[model samples]
Target: MGVNTLYFGVDFGTTNSSVAVYDGHRAWALPLDPENDLPTSLPSLLYISRENEKIVGRAAADAFIARNVDREVKTKQVDLGVSVEAYVGAEPEKSEVFNPALVDPEVRHAVRARATIEVNAPGRLFQSLKSLLRQPAFKSTEVFGTPYQLEELVSYILSPIKKAVDGCAGHAVETVVFGRPVRFSDCDDENRIAEDRLRTAAKLAGFKNVAFFLEPVGACVEYAVSVEEKQCLMVVDIGGGTCDVCIMEFQGGSGPEQRLAESRILSVAGTPVAGDALDREIIRNRIFPLLGSKARYGPSNLPMPQYIYNQILDWQNIYKFNNEEMINWLLAAEAFSNCPEGLRALRCLIQKNYGYLVAREVEAAKKRLSEVESTHITVQRDDIQIDDILVREEFSHIIEYTLGEMRECILEAEQNAGIRPSDINLVLTTGGTCLVPAIRAMLEERYGAGKLRSRDSFTSVATGLAVVARYV
Candidate 1:
């Protein structure tokens, strides 16, 4: 590599993103968003304004909350187009209907239908676009009447990171190595499609040369820097959108690039279950009842619709209730519900668009529970008020399904590697979700507690990717 040539590593994770650079001797994460509490990482979120201006990271989240949360929802009529329709009276002859020239000009007047659209939102907020890369059907979406392809949405997130990188390098660097999940989707074809989409996104972000690196393997590279002798290692990366496990044998002597090139990758596996799923489960199991998920409504006293509350699981889905049909349904349900207070709170949540706020509170509570035995969630917004205590045991139970999937993925990786848990010399855990007590206990039980090691949970992949970027 020429002294003038610079390579940067970008870990564009599902929940957060970071950029790093490696000098010949060392790799370190750059301060992408120093104002942020987590200076090295930025939340992977984007907001597109009505004027088509884009904002990302913490600012994007703050813009969404300040502009949307607790704001009154209003509707407007938008003219799609004009249609010409010919009408014939019930007593009109068939010739009049069949022959347009014979029809009266009065009957041929233009008919226009105006579509009712929800308005008043300052902008549209997009999150977790990385998770949708593997989905073939999620091609594009319109924001404020302008259509944006999936890659374009991702590019917005990358653009800011690249700008920061260029600022640090004192030049516009076009070459980068990005970390990707071992498998974006269950199918190999879908994984390839996801990578291609990511590559396109990087190109749109102004990169000329983009390379992909496995997320788990990147974590492994960081861990390998400390190892001097040969060791069989299993690296588990549980981030916001996916969990990836890689089993490899590493002998560290040379630099990160040479060490990785000489290492043996035994097997790898991944599943789309991680911190985000755990957050949703907390919303579903702990917070739903408070929002009247089980309340009864109508003359027959039927139970409230589970589908309505399920929308709270995803912040984007909460906006669906901004329309007339859903608003009417919520109003009618609140009027007739046995738990009127809960339904009213639910109305406030949807009408005021507080789903993101609620999600953030729940996610914070989840993180707190990881460190403490119990945590309290207090969200007081207009008619909506919630005070709940989440115990660690209950939190563990809430995420059992997700944890079980992770366990299954690990077992699959071990089987593919033709090795048992005991055969592994060390279990390296990285990513945010690895901090959960249950996850740590699970690893300790499967592989001896003494054999488990952890690198920096959040920035290891970015640092390792920087190391790889040096060679790529």
Candidate 2:
């Protein structure tokens, strides 16, 4: 028999990236390692630093000598070689402060040379690079001395994931499929820019031939293979950064013709509000109060700078708070603010770069709410921590607007596809956000619970794309 070589599918998700390949007879998802500790999907995150250290998530941190557990407790804050309390067993000893000022060669050199172990390690971490692509004004972001284009930053996220996939494939693979949403998150409503950035990133990340699949359509392929009857199905994909819907004409299970299922895609729609938006709802409404959003300053009792609270709400802009201008501004306000402790807390979050860390916990809590009536999450590092309970009713109220947008997207797609909610033969919901009780209730209420089906939240798109890769 000729050596079997199979095509690959890559889902470059906003919250996590996943890779899968068709190995002739079946599609297989590529995993990271011997231990399943790390999700087979890599976190869609990148951490840059002046100090040389291997950066991995909490799962892989233990295997390395100079490792920093993202959520590990720090007994004391580590700074540039002075007046710091002891951190009994904190790994990495310290975290290097990465700032935009590093763009100055002299300052960059000085920090690299003189900063302590902690001050010289993991400089700054960036998240949500995928969602920012649609912003026409967001041409580039400065990371140290270089101004990295959106595509370049995307490559930073894609590069390592490719390395893991390539290792599993055991060869230098070039051709691949990429999945994207029906609409990108942009006020300008420009999806072309978002796509071009993705293409450029894939090229930079080591792919020569590329194919694109609408995420929801790709998700439908997974359900298409499970039944022996042809069906008109709607795929509901609510991921970290976007919610996408697709009406697809699916082939019956068990035939070569099913590989050509892409031809049956009817209509697609999407909105850029899902898990990340939901997380922000919690962070802004629940967490910001603890940070100073409610605090006033000066004789006029003016509201504390709204901008400071806004920056840390999204991990993508969290680094913006670490600059001298913001820090100095906070310091000046602390002298006048009625709630200086709140301002101090804000400063601590920025200085330690805990935005992404806290977000991880918030996401966990959101997932917990879907399974139960209420749940609690804890965000902590050293002496600082925010422990709170999240009631589903409150969370649903906070995300009312997001749910509204998602409902409109589904209705629009159904209308465009010339189908009624009753017309869908099957309704397959996938993606992490799909698990939320509110999201579940919305869909079940529309189409009735009888027709609803579920797929793996993290891997469904990749699995579906792998099926699509079999033929085209």
Candidate 3:
């Protein structure tokens, strides 16, 4: 019997991630866990608990909440008459305190505390993710993880995929294709080092063969397969971490020949500012204000609720920590410090799962408003009511901030190709965020509505990579 060749297409995104495999003829999107019909695509979240050295995924999401103190709980108990105290002295209150002498110590303490809690979280998270891969749905010869750098944490996530694929395929699978952004924020040396680490991790995960592909180029290959006619096309793959654009000449026949011409990458452009940032902004600006500040304890000034909210947001964006857990942690921190209003509100927020729920609603609303005229987001707890149906305008502002960079990339691509906008046949868009109307409109206006076309916004890149893996 001959060995069957299998190609795995991975879309390792910042917000959400997915993997698909092509077994010669057709491609199948693998489930993240056995419980769902769809391929396992969830937010790229990894939760670590310093206390237990445990990492968890969707399962940890609830644990985060349970561990997180409800902000609302602390707020409602305002009448309890607990001392409303600030950690730092009150002399510097009512003004922006940027003094390193005063700020450094507090910031150091918070950072150390957070770092300590997160230390063992990644490993535990990998373990939980590994458990997910062991499900019976994705049977393959061997499973592999695709990471930019082969850290144990990355291997943790990848091993499950390898296992699932290996079990499903019913053979000893080896060669795996991993995707990388066209550009990396790290230097060339660092990037190479990262790739080496990733390769090592895959080997440790038990994979025998591993290859790399530029994410956007991989997406182009996926798009080229189904393309019947050859034309000059620009592929824009806007993912969670970076925005990658590729200009390729697709020569079509039985199979398309993709000649990569010019590519542009924006390192700073990402969904961190788009999806997660909006969630945190709402929490800090809207939800936390309702909780009030700590002012009565020991006359020391304390970090503002908004400041803490930003920290929480940053944490969620970077580590994929459980939101409920994060909120509860915040609440517990406040309670331990005896901040009356904050502790009370924190308790309520935890009890009602307000922070996590509101974050989800905000994300949903943003996604909805992107496609439609308006959308409503309802964040309900017993006493807290946050029902703000966002219209296109509000969503537009949020999108515009990100689109500014996209527009620049478009111009750069045009310049690099040395062709005017009219010479381009189509501006093909991919990535989850390309679903936004504002982004679509901006591209249409710039490249001419006739020249603009959006491929499968969600799966185009992954699909493209599948084809690339088969041929490349």
Q: Summarize candidate 2's per-residue lDDT along 125-235 as a digit string, tens digits.
A: 656778888888988876556677888778877776678668867887888888988888644456888888899899998987778988887788766765667778899
Model 2 segments more than 4 A misplaced: 1-3, 33-38, 52-121, 186-189, 251-254, 258-263, 323-325, 380-385
**Clashes by residue pair, model 2:** 94-118, 95-118, 96-118, 96-119, 96-121
Measured with C-alpha atoms, the lDDT of residue 230 in candidate 2 is: 70
TM-score per candidate, in order? 0.88, 0.82, 0.68
lDDT string for model 1 (309-353, tens) is: 665678887876776445545555555579988887887787777
Give candidate 3 regions above 4 Å deviation: 1-3, 34-37, 40-43, 46-86, 90-150, 184-201, 256-306, 315-355, 382-384
Q: lDDT, candidate 2, residue 162? A: 77
Candidate 3 lDDT for residue 435: 68
**What would the TM-score be for candidate 3 when compared with the true structure?**
0.68
Q: Give Cα distance to truth, residue 19, candidate 1, Å.
A: 1.2
What are the clash counts of all predictions, listed in order? Answer: 0, 5, 59
lDDT of 1 at 220: 82
Best by TM-score: 1
lDDT of each: 0.81, 0.71, 0.53
Q: Give residue 112's lDDT in candidate 1 (0 to 100).
A: 31
| Candidate 2, residue 65: lDDT | 16
* lDDT-sorted candidate list, best first: 1, 2, 3
